[model samples]
Target: VLVASFAHFCSFDRCNSASSSSVLLNALPRPADPAPGHLQCPTCVTVFGSCPQNSDIVTCPNGTSHCYNGHIAIRGGGISSSMNIQGCVAKPSSFLLNHTQNIGVFTVMENRNQGDERGEDWNNPIIQAGAAPVSAPFLAWVVGLGLSLALWGGAPSLPVLYWSGPCPHWTS
Candidate 1:
């Protein structure tokens, strides 16, 4: 009889503690969600055509953080068409930008700015399809050196090397 009474008390105590903990959990507050950002970008969709004269600028929905611009041309299986698109995107496309190629039935190109290309935008001074841009720092240093030399009435003593091809009249 003593054991039975002790077991009943222990069970009651356990249940009471569990309920108290549950109440504490319920009373604790949770961290609130972050507010969404307001980012606007151009939005357009064209099929076998170009973007309209005045494409719409739209507020990107939450989680979309890029402005996408791409072109895709399909020509196979009796299908010949192209699609141009510009819009707010969650991620940028992986197509090569500012270049053209023939790949199976799909010729894809992308010319989007993904917010990271701020100072190094590809179109500022214009560049060829497959050429690395000259470093601005190097150019600045060269210009500074030239100006300093000009101000000092100095010329480079090193010979100007100009051998475009094997010297035209020389035979090896």
Candidate 2:
């Protein structure tokens, strides 16, 4: 009976020690990691993709525009007349471990065609074999007009009227 009581006392003491240590751990202040400021996007809620680095031409998959700093950005169109973005969330850190906060969504103005890769013609073929003739339609129109003028001696002075509508009521 004394051995059992001693074992129970040892377990109770262990439990009490664990609870006391947990309380102390909770009381300790967590380390203050340097967090980024509140990020704001001038366009939408989410951003284009990964936080844009120092690149003027960042084409996010979601079509968001990013400036140098992740804080300010534009999407869809120009800064002057684009949707005001909100909820700029922080991006994952370079180490891929901690994310302090989200950076805002970036917006690209409609008229701001700067840095757009779509304008480049790199993929377009310079010369295509057996391509449709460019001026064929124009040549046909010119030939048809010339033949009509030669055969009819030019258009009539008065407009040509077609009597396709029902005849007007002719009262006796």
Give the best candidate by lDDT: 1
lDDT of 2 by residue, 75-170 (tens): 321112221111111232111112212212222222222222222221221113464322111000000001111112322111111111121111
Candidate 1 lDDT over 7-51, as tens digits, reads 112333223222112232233343332233344444444655776
lDDT of 1 at 104: 37
**Candidate 1 overall Cα lDDT vs. reference?**
0.33
Off by over 4 Å in 1: 1-37, 92-172
Each candidate: RMSD: 33.1, 37.3
Clashes of each: 0, 19
**What's the true lDDT of residue 74 in model 1?**
43
The TM-score of predicted model 2 comes to: 0.14
